[model samples]
Target: MTQTGTASKTVFGVPVPVALFFIAMMLPTAVSVNLGGLRLSAYRVVLLVMILPMLLDLVSGRRGRAHVFDFLVLAHCGWALLALINWGGVAQGIESGGIYIVEFAGAYLLGRLYIRSYEDFAAMARAYVGLVLTTLVFTVPEALTAIHILHDGISGAVGGPMAPYIEPRMGIERTFGPFDHPILYGVFSASSFSLAYFVIAKRQLMNFSGMAKVVGVVLATFMSASGGPYLVLMMQGFVCAWQRVLGDVQGRWAALFSLFALAYIAIDLFSTKSPFHVFVNNFTFSRESAYNRILIFEFGSAEVARYPLFGIGLGDWVRPVWMSDSMDNFWLVTAVRYGLPALFLLLALLIGLVWTVGQRKNLPPEWRRARHAWAFTLFGITVAAATVHLWNALFVLFLFLIGAGAWLLDAKPDPKKGRMTQASFKLPFRPAARLF
Candidate 1:
């Protein structure tokens, strides 16, 4: 029995498979080895491997309540296949689409299956913290030497360069360590800042250890040296400040968001320069570097209009010759690649997750706190997605959170019993079918 009262088999309070999953997720590249022509990433491989338990449960006839988001995820995958087909070749489509199916579908299903309780959510959060800490082992050295240790080995293992150490930006080489990019490392580090603080806020971690972990995450974000992550950090700080200063944040958050959206629209309509150009020019000192992103939106709008239904195809957008095919914005990118319906589904999924957080009055105290924090975190990610493509490790990490949120939303504590029974697979049926 664990904190959530589910019968958990664990080596040291943490379930063995869950622990292995976290290790695989956290050390995807570090544990990776090249086999002939294939570079086997531990993270990707482990995510697939983790499917075994769920399959076994399915074979054993475990079923739970299905949420709207579940269908949306599957639908998203279907759209992905269609988009890949739009790309041109059936073989290439399967090859490209298969990985995505693994990540979006596989990760989501894994989360829904395993992370069925708050205790599981908490364990995963701790594992995320562990993962972040582990990266510093390599990131610190890379930062000091201006060299990435994982670069040569990972590339050689993959049979090609996977994460080439790039030239320094602003005279400082960003340290990504084992991650694919510095921006990804930075965004991931900044993303975890809120989760780390959540543990402290809940009084889960204490004294020197907790403070040190928080400080380490802060430093990691700084070492990333990317503007996007810096913005995410600032957004998180603002969210925290909003919660502190205001007695309740919902009303004020909505008002502020509305005002900002309106202001952005107003600027885009009235100003000679579009809002994207204006924002890039004013918000970032490296205006030249951000020009491509601004162009993505500027050109992406036309692309969105062109393929309002099913998109032109995955990775097959007609961009200005000067502009690369990169659609940096998640909403725009999804709209362009998978079509508007897919984009709408993505938005529905995100909004639904946040909305689920506050929909109930009977939420456990712990879940109540999670509701507020996750709402802000989701908002921050949405903002960050505008600047970077969302198909990175950060998205994978976020999928787990979404699964947790779904669990919280669907679960209701028993009033008479005074606690919820842990949903488990019994011989013939799932015990938590009603709760689901």
Candidate 2:
């Protein structure tokens, strides 16, 4: 899709975004990825997750300017077909493939919606940073009140309810930093600061106060005990800021993102910081959580064997209640459930996007920073997935950032041209199509 007048794109008759949204909404209900720690589900629901994102493209008329991001959807589509006939082991493969689709599409859709413009992308980054800051400040108290801290449900005793905060691990209770879980907190925080750091290093953030705000956000993410998410996101941020934002700047913004990352690690390592109470209190591996996805995939191999290709049918993974409680690594899970071919297809789709976004010529310095920020943000998401689900609200913020960055690149030259003036519709994306 090359960007033009709004026209409803669809296959048969369903709007892709809408359909996928429904499937995501239904996924948990139809089949819990965690079946009381058994980690087995009905495969049919998984299929819906796979096919849904594609519908987004089919319905977008394929000529829409934002088609570059749509490449991800294509990857999922390939996974779907591969799963369908997965080396003739179709059943288990389809279900697993379906599940991954839900996770991937959820993140992508948010990117399409919120990141529709440079301003929106920047706003999302700021907001995420703000969230991290808020959590950092709030966690101080949560950390202070020993008894009230661990003996709780939602979180925040002296303050208000933090709907998205979570502390899955025992010792260092990662305060959702902002969205859902510690890992998610890590993902969101990493993406948030990565963008902020890029902007600052490249001078795109502008002004001393804004730069300070960006730093504050990055610092907050550090304090929250997110583990792996914290480490990886920092590296991705560094690479992006250096290549995309800095261009040829000496030791300034070019390496700013990395510096922040290093500083964060240094503080965490040297400081007497600890989850403190959680460390003294309960500590269980919770092997059933995101940490044990590998186990789940191992068990799923047999299930896939039953349906080598084409899958058990076309649905979520249906474990007969007695299945083991283990989650698969995204790569293996895709193959065992959908087939090896589907996994390859999925990778191709993502790699293609990486190639397209990585190419840029003589963009203005500021625009260049913005571009690198989004590109790095996308790559970072890919890396972050290894540890946690990418769809959590925290990481989804990056999706918005990328969209905004793209919008900035393609923004209308004339203020009045191609822009909707009405507050009722002109926000972004489907303003023309949304009016219906």
Candidate 3:
């Protein structure tokens, strides 16, 4: 008898997963490993802990193919096999593959395990939003410092061999703002920022209050100087246009949302105080680096042409053919490293997800709206992935959760003696869902 509402069990009645999730979600402090003469980040080191639960399950009790988690596991296996085969060129094939697995895949799975119910989902949403906010909080100071350090507006940040591959063209600093990198931070901001828009837009549709936070975060993302985020976010607007084409939900707000998105883009394009300029200064100002991404993209296409079957390999990004001395633009990276197959898998997963979510005909109206935004947000994120890898962990994790969560709720609703059982999965922590 599965308990309804809150107070329901998570993962065989253990509360540790949620706690573990919090720790894992915290912005990691520096740490690394010492392999003889080599050292790796402590953050990377802890990533391994995330794999234990899944690994144990795989070994202890095998599950049938009907399981939702199975696909995620399959993707990782494919990634591993690709890594092994391509070896990313033994010359510089070295990357924190283990850490990449744990940190990137681990975080997503943690979200899934902990976000088992509706309240949990809300909590998860808040937690994810919180991270975005956290990044923004730190970014204010970081950007200020970065500005002073690099002296923004004076000239573009100087580009060196270690600078962004595309910086030579754009001249923008692409400042990190307390994140690992400015471009990475911007990508994170854009992904979460898009999610925030989803929330605010839904609120408008529902006549709910809380548009303030989304406004603030969107502003913060603009300051990150990462061109990819700007480009991806713009794509979200295009997606909303497509959604309107699908006729999922028709109303003034839908059109208004589209209009608002366009207005934002227009303003950014003309704004002279380019956030990109502040960060990259020089990288984006030049035509050479501006066009370099195309060259790199071509590089990937050539590699794919030579090896169209399987990719160079998944784990070997730093290898000569794929990611060697290049920046991450989602489509090219996937095509180069794993060949065409990996990129195809990505498209298939995204399309399949969009279809499943769009088919949720039984959820409560509010839940339906929430899921709609989820799908649209994903659409934007996928487009953004073409230019940024933030989708790798932070954004992609949420997408997987939505897909699995929707699948979990597809069964017929429980008809209580009273009102119809909530047509959604209630979280373990929501006040209404709470057991206490």
Candidate 4:
């Protein structure tokens, strides 16, 4: 349903639905219940609770025109389930596959339905900034003390530890916050970098509060001490700088793409290792970690080649005895677990959304800025996911962000003038008191 007035329902300056999603994500995984054989965590429970309303909105056309990415998401879920059923029996397959459907499709539909306007998106960005600030209170201390306060407290209240202790790196502990892993925590924090700077800053890049938001995000990211999150921060920072400096230049993005292509070709032609191998080696934290990822890619791709259709499912993959069973790469893991089609559909949804949203014309300056922010955020995530595996909250949040951008596609221009509309980018809440 459309908002009644100029503003939407909000709590503490954040949209109600957006705040709910953030709260669900921040909840400790320990706060969960087992249903039959399935374990449903806090975020999963939230998704389950919202599924009916989301479906009804979709059926009634209240969410507006559906995009190809929506269908791709559904197809990805459907094919994944079919493949799982083919590998395992129907009962086992449904049991395993249903979890993914709830996590991916459910979170995605929430974003697609509730966040249907500029006000909602801006509120989401503001809520994200607030989340980064709040989490920093836990992440900084956790990084120094090697004790995750929020996670430990929740686990203690629930009678057990939720996550295993990760050893310190570079004479300091890697911060886990309330997430499953330090990298996930870092990636989640890093996702807001572009949003905070581009969307929150609006027309001025050096706005004081906007810079504070950026610093908060950077601090939270550094607490993770993981290469994946560091890469995201660096990439997003570079893109932001590029836009600020050369935004008026024609074909700037095309030039950047061409330069990357040239570099990839040069590395492939001259280097002994493949471009992908070199990329993995250079972007990792330690020599051992780099070598391990290289071996994983080498072996994981082989497994995908062996089982190109339905994948091996729960069966053990053929890897060296010394190699770890964990697959660090999310894209490779998807291909290895559910076949190439699953990966293809996911890639299509991601690439198609970014491309289509960027290509939209006649958007106001505010909408255009938000589009760029969302695009670069996804761009960094796409590269980072190739390096680290994402699961649970991180995965659901990724899908939700994608769905939240669907409103850009259906945005209408000034029909009478047939040109860009000039709309003031003002939030409904008091800027000075609420934003900072």
Candidate 5:
């Protein structure tokens, strides 16, 4: 799939950029390799590989264009740096805040530069389907035998501490499946399920392969056995129905706001607790964990009121030695860590990305497939992340989703000339004819 006389050459079958993107996205986080006496996770190494070409492109005066969302993401990082600076000294900001920016913001930049068109995006989708299928092979064995082959095997090689395995819950041993936690594993698969289905629905994937991908993602989700992922999958169904039955996009938003209002009113009338506390208490599988989360949210809310503008820098805001490890909700973590301004910037990034993709009506039919795929992917992940702490690989993956949506939103289609416009590009492989 080479563009003649261009740098987009194929490597081992896939285009070079697409291959690097695929490796960076799909390489198992449970694995790592050492280079020059330094140990690094597989994803870090793959990201370095992806970044190398981008750096070369910059040197060659072929640096990719930036979008508005890039600045919004940067603002989120800038706020995070300020928070870290307030919490600790410059060293902490440089180490933690800088790394956060590189992991989250860098992922979006890499995605925007590499995945410039729908064809590149589809190649990534195909690679994602492959990842789902491959993960299933390990998960199925782990589900039945209670053996984490990938985790156990890679632990020795990585020479770093791995997340400890927990006992089975609700008669299911939550499968790690190459992710740090079962919840993340589930959210990752469930997100792929929605994204793959969106692509399939748009006829981007061959019938058989698309169906197989859907089946594979479903199996992986169930293997994760996390309530959060199940909720995310359910939300995808709700969103699909909301889009179909509930008028249009605006109508869906109205309905969502109405539901939130009703839930808030119900919480006020029925209990002496906040809606978030009431909602998570019933939604979570582990009552103990859920209670702690409620306490965290309660304590974090107080911290927000006290430091509404700038926020009380990190340290142990949540009391009790047991629960002080973290605040589970991604939104809460951002608010408590970086203050309300940072949280607002993050919200703007997510909402703006989704709105730009979902509201676009001028995209080509093929490009439209990617638009919907990314919209639902972000929506599902947003819902999932609300209840979970997104760190490491998952946070990077989320930023990649935002970057993809931003790229698609800025793209323009040239249906008349059949040329690559700022919005659309010609496919390297004929999607209609390809089976895999």
Candidate 6:
């Protein structure tokens, strides 16, 4: 939906600033340096490198008046740090909590500062597409052979593999690419589905290049062979299709919401399991996985009840000895790891941003389309997080996208040209900006 423009600043054709973040995420976690007992991975290093400039932008009010969402993010990070300190003591807390701050708040600030307009958002999407496509070179083969070429190469060079080898599922190898798990890779790829479709495809279903990007996204997600990523793709696909078919209908989303509420209520009344349990059972790859997640919610909530203010931090959660330590639900894990306040702040940030962006009015057609794409992507991800846990790079990326969409709230309509322009922010760095 972005208008044609000169190319933006790029490194080897990918957009800068955001390019730095995406490139760092694409690298293996094994690629890191242990500096003074703190391990700085590529993404962490990039976040640290860019933090000062981003803070300067925020302090200067170059981006815009700070919104409640901004404070919510900061508060979430603060509470998380406090919880860690409460559990681990000051020194260990700072060491661990500092990493979360850099990865979460730092990545969010990068998106908030750098992507300040539609063109900027488009450039970010293009950079993501390029990165996903590049990874396909290794992912596709890894999926087929179960021999992670990129990870193997990095492991050999770095002295060990960061991600453990996952056994094949349904006779096909689950490929994680550079991430620590197949679900993370799948989620990373699936997050781009709507962006590629609406921004790259430009709402034209028949457009070859756009469709190619969509197909590529699906292929990459499929390589992960994980139910969580598959769920993301399906949710985005359904939302995109609903938009396409009902774009002309007023209150369509409201009607859809009503229908969903009715279905949820009906399921809650009739089904022996709660709606969430039923949903998880139907959606996962196996009943065992679904049952485990149910138990996670049961025991995980009990733990939360015990430590309501500051969670157990990195300490082990109470569960059956037979149960694995892994907590698959991201939202639950946040509450379990930190506290309810931390989880509440995060949910508020995510839901608040999505609501504010979607409620913006009088946008030009292009900007409106872009808003839908961004909002829909986040919506799918918000739901997907309940089914899968996000950590490391994927977690940073999830927060980054929330920050990236904040610009939409500040878009003002230009009366003279009947176009949408960023409010209170001037383009600080623009170098010729092309999407393709």
Query: What TM-score would candidate 4 get against the native?
Result: 0.91
The alpha-carbon lDDT assigned to residue 369 of candidate 2 equals: 61
Write the residue-wise lDDT of candidate 1 on 151-220 in tens digits. 5455566565556657666556787756677877887777767766665445344566766777788778
Q: Which residue pairs clash within candidate 5?
A: 411-423, 412-422, 412-423
Residues 291-336 of candidate 4 have per-residue lDDT tens digits of 8888888899999999998887766789999887989999998999
TM-scores of the candidates are 0.82, 0.55, 0.65, 0.91, 0.83, 0.91
Better of 3 and 6 by TM-score: 6
What is the Cα-based TM-score of model 1? 0.82
Q: Which segments of model 4 are wrong by more than 4 Å?
A: 1-9, 13-15, 203-205, 413-436
Q: Write the per-residue lDDT of candidate 5 for residues 320-397, one digit (tens) a residue.
A: 775666777888788887899999988887886676566656556667657767776777778766678887677777
Q: Can you rank all candidates by lDDT, best first? A: 6, 4, 5, 1, 3, 2
Query: How many backbone clashes does every candidate have?
Result: 1, 58, 41, 0, 3, 6
Candidate 2 residue lDDT tens string, 1-436 = 2221223332222233433432332222223355442343222233344345435543553323444445555465555756555433566555555444444554455445424434334544554455555555655454344222321332344243444345534454455422334455555556655566655444545677767766766655564555456544665655754565555666554365587677667766776643321221222134444324433443556656766554433445645465443332344455554555565655664555444444444545555566666667666665545444444333234333443443442343235423312222122233222111
Candidate 1, after superposition: displacement of residue 82 in Å? Answer: 2.2
Pairs that collide in candidate 6 are 6-432, 6-433, 7-432, 7-433, 7-434, 8-433
| Candidate 6 segments whose C-alpha is farther than 4 A from its true place | 1-9, 12-15, 413-436
Q: Which candidate, 1 or 5, would have the higher TM-score against the true structure?
A: 5
lDDT per residue (tens digit) for residues 77-195 in model 6: 88999999999999988888988888888988887766767767787788787788888999988878878888778866888665686778877899978887899999999999989
Model 1 ranges off by over 4 Å: 1-18, 27-40, 51-64, 89-92, 150-163, 201-208, 265-272, 283-285, 362-364, 412-436
